[model samples]
Target: MITLAGKKALVLGIANNRSIAWAIAQAFHSAGAELAVNYLPDEKGRFEAKVRELTAPLAPAIFAPCDVRDDAQIAHLFETIASKWGRLDILVHCLAFGNKEDLQGPFTQIRRDGYSLAMEVSAFSLIALANRAVSLMPDGGSILTLTYIGSTRVMEGYGVMGPAKAALEANTRYLAAELGKQNVRVNAVSAGPIRTLAASGLGNIHEAIHKTEAASAIKRAVTQEEVANTALFLASDLASAITGQTIYVDCGFSIMGG
Candidate 1:
């Protein structure tokens, strides 16, 4: 069995049970890794309650508050992880945000603030989290982030999020290069469309979902569990030789030829 026993993972951006982050958390738990969840400041107590309800049987880890947008909060998050676990073995950067308006309209109409906010939340946060995680990953570790096909291909209504994911994909490669020297592996999982809370913000996302499934070789949508399985592999020692790669778990959707 590919076990993550004794490993500790920090998972961010679990908006709800349907979130890919939650799926990753469950996968890591099943593989024997202890899980620590991060909740946004606004939803601290609320999400804590939810985590408690979900994790009570296994009692995986305490849900800590972390708003990735705030440097102070991010600093405190890493500090707490260091103090409690003394080290971190895996980091899942599932955080991303964007102005709904910018996601729906023409890319050229995106406002400066909306564009900047999208990049900061959707792309740069991964870099910020990785920088802090390296200090705690003394024995080497894995860092994974989520991306989409929109990064390289234009998808309707994906708008600025596409460019943001492009930057995120680039960040994964650049950071992997720098972090590999320390024995840490960094990668991105470009997933097929799922009805996550974040994806709901996109205008007419249902159409995008249909288009993706219709194009995929499987002729069906990819589930969060499918993506989580890929994340689990990348986070395990079995994938020690893999880094700076974007693994797509989209039922071969990204490989479709016109």
Candidate 2:
């Protein structure tokens, strides 16, 4: 059994029970890893309250607010980890966002600001988080991010997020190379379409899921738990030598020829 006993894992990007990050957190917890989770800050504290209630069953050791766009919040998050756990063993990054306008319509029509926002939130945030996460990972650790097949192939309605995910995959490789000396592993998990709140923004999400089920080798869409299991393997010593790669949990959807 792949066990993460005593390992401290920080999972970011959980929006609700349906979030892939939430599933990862649950998987990590089941594997015996100590968990820390993050929620985006809002004026009303609604996000914090929802996350706190949703994660209560798992009893995460550290639950805090982190807006990856805010350097101060990022620093504070790492500071909290440092004060509470001293060191981190796994960092799970499942964050991604794109404006509604940018996520549909013609790619050429994408606004500059929307494009920039997509890149910053979906791609650049990984680099920013990795920068801080490495500091807390004085010992070797795993850093994982979520990506998608749209990053490589053209997927209608995926829009600006396609390029953002492409950048994220590129960043994964580069980070893995640079951090290998420090024994830090960086990788991305490319999951099949799911009906998560974030994915609901996409125009062709239902079509994508149906097509994946009809044509993929497994003939079904991959579940959040399935993706989370891959994350669990990557986070544990089982994948000690696996890094700088995008492991697809897409029911082989990416392999079929158009």
Model 1 Cα RMSD, 1 decimal: 1.5
Whole-model lDDT values for every prediction: 0.90, 0.94
132-220 per-residue lDDT for model 1 (tens digits): 99999999999999999999998888888999999999999999999999999999999999998888988677887898789899999
lDDT of 1 at 20: 96
Name the regions of candidate 1 deviating beyond 4 angstroms.
43-48, 55-58
Clashing pairs in 2: none
Error of model 2, residue 162, in angstroms:
0.4
- TM-score of each model, paired residue for residue: 0.96, 0.99
In TM-score terms, candidate 2 sits at: 0.99
* Backbone clashes in model 1: 0
Residue 105 error, candidate 2, Å: 2.0
List candidate 2 segments past 4 Å from native: none
| Most accurate candidate by TM-score | 2
